[model samples]
Target: MNAELLARFHGVIPAGGVGTRLWPLSRAAAPKFLHDLTGSGSTLIRATYERLIPLAGGNIMVVTGRAHRTAVIAQLPEVSDLDLVLEPEPKDSAAAIGLAAAILYRRNPETIMGSFAADQVIRPVEVFQEAVLEAIHTAATGKIVTIGIRPTLPSTAFGYIRAGERLDISGAPTARDVVEFVEKPDGDTARRYLADGGYLWNAGMFVAPVSLMLKHLERSEPELYAGLTEIAAAWETPARDETMDRIWPNLPKTAIDYAVAEPAAAAGDVAVIPGVFDWDDVGDFAAIGRLNPASEETGVTVIGDVKRVYSDNATGVVVTDSKRVIALIGIHDVVVVDTPDALLVTTKEHAQSVKNTVDTLKKNGVMDVL
Candidate 1:
C-alpha cells in the first residue's frame, strides 16, 4: 500500500437513500444499506466503509440523513463527529456529495475527494484499488474523474459513459477523456451501446480535487453551491444546526449526474478511468438474486437463517429478518421477504415494481409498515 498516495486522498460516502425497491426487508426506518443483504455478516454501509479504509484511512466522511445518523454512527464507530456530514433532509446526491466537497474545501482546498455510494458491491478488491489510485492521480491534475465500469452486457439498468481520446498520464495509463454520459437506454439503444466499443456503465464513483468540484458546482449550480458554502462555513460553529435547518430543505433536489457530470463532460473537463472489476448497485430483488443466486440443490437463495427456510421445487429468493419459518413449495421465480411488520411477495419479473408497493401503502395511509 502506498501510504503517501493514500494520505493525499479523502473518501466521501453518501448514504441517504431509502431503497424503496427492496421493501419489507429494506424499510423507511432501516434502508438497504443498513441491512446485510449479501449474507456476509456485515451491513452494506459497513462493507463500504471497510472498502475505503485502506485508501483514505481516517480521512473519510459519510453524509447521511439525520434520521439514520445514529445507525450510521453505530455501524461506523471509527468515524468522528467532524467526519459525519449529516443532512437534515434528503436533497439527493448533489446536495449530499456537494456538501461533503464544500466542507472538505473549507478544511483543505487541495484535498482530493472521492465519492462512493453506500449501497454498492464490488469484487476483486485489488482491481478496485488500482482503479481508484489511477482516478486519484487523474483528479489531482484539475480534471473531474469518474470510474466507468466495463459493460458485460447491454444492461439497461445503468447509465453509460462514452470514452474519447486516451490521456497519456504516467500513473493513470488507462485514463481517457469522457465523451458524454447517456441515461439508461431502451433494449435496442442498450444493444447499440454494447455494439459500440467506446461505452462503459456509469458506476457513480467520482474523484476530484475539492477545489475543482466546488468550482464546477459554483458554475453549474450557483444557488446550491452558495447554500452549501454557507453551511460549510458554519459546519463547526454553533450556527451549524440553525444554518442547515433553515437552508437545506429549500435547496434543489438534483443528482450529481445532471447537476455536474453531464455539464462537465460537455465542456470536456470530465475524465473516465475504466474499471474492470465486477460491480453491482443492488438496486432491486433481481439484482440480489443475480449477486447471490439460488442454491443448485435447494433452488432457493436464502439471505438469513438458512435452517429456518425449507424449500422444495421452489426457485427464487427468500429473505427473513424475523424468527418465522419460511416454507416455499412448487413456487418458481417468486420473491418472499418477511419482516416483523410486513411481507413482500412478488415475482422476480415484477421486482422492479416493488417501489410501487411502497407508494400503495402510502396511499392507503399505512405508515406503520413503512
Candidate 2:
C-alpha cells in the first residue's frame, strides 16, 4: 500500500488454500502458503504479510481453516489467537471473505481492508502500492475494487478481467471500469483476449471498505450475510462457538468470483485498476522456479541451485531432499525436485504439470508423502 493510502486501511490475508499442487513437501496439514517455497528468508504467507506491514500494523487478519491452523500458528510468529479468523470448516472465498468482513466490522466498523492472496509475488514495492492505492480510491467511491495486471502471456491458469473506461484518481494508477470477468480461458481465447487489448490477468488482489463488502453480501448473498452475521452476533456472549458451528458448515463452497464478485460485476458495481507491477502468482513449482538466483556463466536468473549445477543450465532451478548431493552431470532445460518420499524431474516447460504427480500419489494412497 502507498504511504498516503496506508493512512486508512487494514490488510486481509486469505491463507486457506489446501495447496494440493505443491505436494510431497506441502501436506494437507501444512499448505503451500505456509511453506518456504521461495527459498527466501520467509514463507509465502509471511513474506506477503510482511510486505503489508507498512500499511497495517499488528492489525493484520489471516483467515484459515482448522486443518492448517497448527501450521499457521507454527509458521507465522506475528499472528495471535485474536488475529486469526478461524473458520470452523473449509468454506471457499465467499465464506472466508464474509467472515473477514464481520470480524473486521466488530473491531472497526468502517475499516478499509485490502485483500491479499498470500501466494503471489510482486516486485518493486512502489508498483504494488500504486495498484493498491488505485483500488482503494475506487473502493472509496463505493465500487468493489480488484487489481488487473497486463497479461504477459496467454495463460489459461488465471482468470481474466476485461478493462474498460479509465477513471481519474490522483496518486493512483490507471483505474478502469471492469467490463466483464472471463474465467480461465483456453490458450486460443487467452491469446485473443491479450492481443485484442482491454484484457488483464485477474490478480485476485482486492480492496473494499468493510461496510461496503458487508453491504455487497447483504445485497447479493443474503443467506451468507445473515449466517455470518449470526456468527458475529454470537461473539457477544455465550453463543459464539455454537453459532459458527451451525452456520459455517452450510456456507457454499464457492469462490468469491462465484459468490459475490460475479454478481457485483453483473450489476456493474466492480472496477479493475491497472496493476503495472511485476507480479506473478506462484501457483506451482515452475512458477516458484522463476524466482531463483542468477547464474554464474550468463547471469541468467534461476531458482533451486542444487539442480542447476547438475544440468549446467544458466537459468536452472533444481531441488532435492537427498541427504546426499544432487548433481546434474549434463542436462539442460530440466527441473529436478526431490523429497524424502518422492522425486520429480521434468523439462522446465512441463514443470507446472508436475502437479499431476500429486494426484497420482493420492490415488495410490500414499498419504505420508502428501
Candidate 3:
C-alpha cells in the first residue's frame, strides 16, 4: 500500500440515509448500515471502516444523524468523539459531506478527504485499494476524483459517468477526465451505454482536496456553503450545538451529485478512476439475493440462521432474526422478511416497491409495524 499517499488523505463516511427498500431488516430507528445484511459478522459501517483503515489509518470521520450517533459510535468503537460529526438532522449528502469537509479544512487546509457511503458493499479488497490509491493521486492534482465502477451489465440502477480523456498522473495510470455525469437511464439507454463502452457506473465514492470540494460548493451552492462554514467555525467550540441549530435546518437538502459533481464536471474539474471490485449497494432483496452465495443453488437466500429456515420446492429469499421457524413450500420468486414486530411477504419482482408499503403503513397510521 502507498503509506505516504494514504497518510496524506482522510476518510469520511456519510451515514445518514435510511435504506427504505430493505425495510423490516432496515428501519428508521436502526438503518441498514448498522446491520450486517450480508451476515458478514460486522455491520456495513464497520466493514466500510475496515476497508479504508489500512490506507486512512486513524484519520477517519463519520457524519451521521443525532438519533443514530450513539449507535454509530457503539458500532465503531475505535472512532474517537472528535472524529465523529453528528448532524442534528438529515440534510442529504451535500450537507453531510460538506460539513465533514469544512471541519477537515479547519483542521488543516491541505487535508485530502474521500467520502464513501456507509451502506455500500465492495469486494476483493486489493483491487478496491488500488482504485482508491489511484483516486487519491488524481484528487491530489486539484480535481474532484470519483471512483467509477466498470459496468459489468446493463443495469439501470446506477448513474453513469462518461469518461473523456486520460490524465497524466503518476501511480494513477488509469485515471481519466470525467466528461459528464448521467442520471440512471432506461433499459435501452443502459444497454447502449454498456455496448458503447465509454460510461462507468458512478459509485458515489469521491476523493478530493478539502479546498477543491469547498470551492466547488461555494460556486455551485453558495447558501449551503455558507451554512457549512458557519457550523464548521463553531464545531469544536461551546457554540456548536447552538450554531448548528440555527443554521443546519435551513441548509439546502441537496445531494452532492446535483450540488457539486455535475457542475464541477461541466466546468472541467472532475476525474474518474475505474474500479474493478465486486460492488453492491444492497438496495433491495433482489440485490441481497444476488449477493448471497447460498442463493446460487436454488435461487433461495437466507440472511439469518439457516437451521431455522426450511423450504420445500421453494425458490426465493427468506430473512429472519426471530426465533420462530420460517417454512416455505412451493413458493417461487418470493421474498419473506420476518421480524419480531412485523412480517413482510412479497415477490422478488416487487422488491423495489417495498418502500411504497412503508409509505402506505405510515399513511394508515400503522406505526407499530413501521
Candidate 4:
C-alpha cells in the first residue's frame, strides 16, 4: 500500500439499525452492532473501526443515531467527538453516508471516502484491507467504487452485483465496470445467478472521492444534498448542533445503493473490486449459529455461559443473558434467546420470520419489551 494513497483515505461507518430479525438480543436501545454476536470478544462496531484504522488511521468518521451516542462512544473511545456524526432520527443510509461524504468533501476535496456498515462480520482482515485498497485506488480515478463480495452460496438474503469487462486501472488490477445492481432474487433466480458466475453479492460497501459521492447525491437527490450541504457547512462551527437538529429529521430516507450506486452504474461511472474475504451480515439466529463454534459434546452453539446451557441430542444456537439455566432435549435446529425481560424460541429455518414478531408487538402496543 502506498503511504501517500493511504493518507488520502477516510473511512465512514454507518451504524444504525435495530436488526429486528435478531430481536430480543438486538434492541432499539442497544442494537446488534453493540453486541459480540460472533463471540469474537470485540463488538461489531469496534471490530469495524479496527479494520479501517490500518488504512485510514485517525481519518475515520462514524454516522449513527442519537440514541446510541453514549454506547457508541463507550465502545469506540478512540473516535473523537468531531468524528462522530449523530442523526436525530434514523434517515437510513443515504442521509447517514451522504452527510459524511459532504463533510469530508468540505474538509478536503481530494479525500477518498469508504463507507462500511458497522454490523457485519468479515474475516482474514488482510484480504478485506487489500480489497479496500484496490477500491480506494479505483475511486481516485473519479469513479464510484463498491467492494462486491464473491458469493459463496445462492443466498436470496443479499442483493447481487453484475460485473462487466475488467478495467485497466494503474493500481487496481482487479477492478471491473459494474453492469447493474440487482435486488434480492427468488430462490430459483439466485441459483441461476450462482450458476452464471458473473454475479457478486452486493455487500453495500462503497469507496469514492468525497466530491464524486456528493455529485451523485446532488444529481439524484437534490433536496437531500442541499440539506446535507447546509449541515456540512456548519459542521465545524458552533452552529453544528443547531443545523443538524433543524434539518436532519426532514431529510429523505433511502439506502446509498438506491441513492447513488445504481444511478452511477447506469451512467457508466461505477466500478467494483472483488472481495474474496469471508463476509457475513449475521442477519438472524441461523447466521449466529453458523458464525459461532458448536460444543463438541452438545452440538449446541452458545453465546453466553456455556455451562448454563445443557443440551442432549439437539443442535441449535442459544443465547442467555440471565443466570437461569436452559436445557434442551430431543430438539433440532432450534434458536433460544433468553433475555431478562423476554425469551425468544424459534427454529433456525424460521429465523428470518422473527421480524414478523417484532411487527406484531408494535401493533399490539407492547413497547416495554421492544
C-alpha RMSD by candidate, in order: 1.4, 2.9, 1.6, 0.9
lDDT tens string, model 2, 1-370?
4555566688889987666665555667767787666678678888888888766777688988877777777767788766677787788888888777887788777678889987777788777876777777778777888888888888999999988788776645578777888889999999899898899888778788888778878887888888888887776568776787878888767677876777777788888887787887776666666766546663333333344233343344556555646666455566666776677777668766767877887799977877
TM-score of each: 0.97, 0.89, 0.96, 0.99
Clashes of each: 0, 3, 0, 0
Candidate 2 ranges with C-alpha deviation above 4 Å: 1-7, 236-238, 297-315
Tens digits of per-residue lDDT for model 3 on 23-116?
8888888899998888788889999999989889899999998889789988999999778988888998999999999999999998889999
**Number of the top-ranking candidate, with lDDT as the measure:** 4
* Model 2 residue pairs with clashes: 292-302, 292-303, 310-328
Regions of candidate 4 where Cα sits further than 4 Å from its true position:
305-307
Q: In candidate 1, what are the lDDT values of residues 1-370, reduced to their tens digit?
A: 3466568799999997888899977877799899887878889999999989888988899999889988998999999998998888789999999999999988888789999999999888789989999998898777899999999899988999999999988689999999999999999999998899899999899999888888888899999999999999999999999999999988988999988899999988899999999998899988889888678888989887644888888899888878898889999999999877788899899999999989998999999888
Question: What C-alpha lDDT values do all the predictions have?
Answer: 0.90, 0.75, 0.90, 0.93
How good is model 2 by TM-score? 0.89
Runs in model 1 deviating more than 4 A are 1-5
Local distance difference test, candidate 2: 0.75
Task: Write the number of the candidate with greater TM-score, choosing between 2 and 3.
Answer: 3
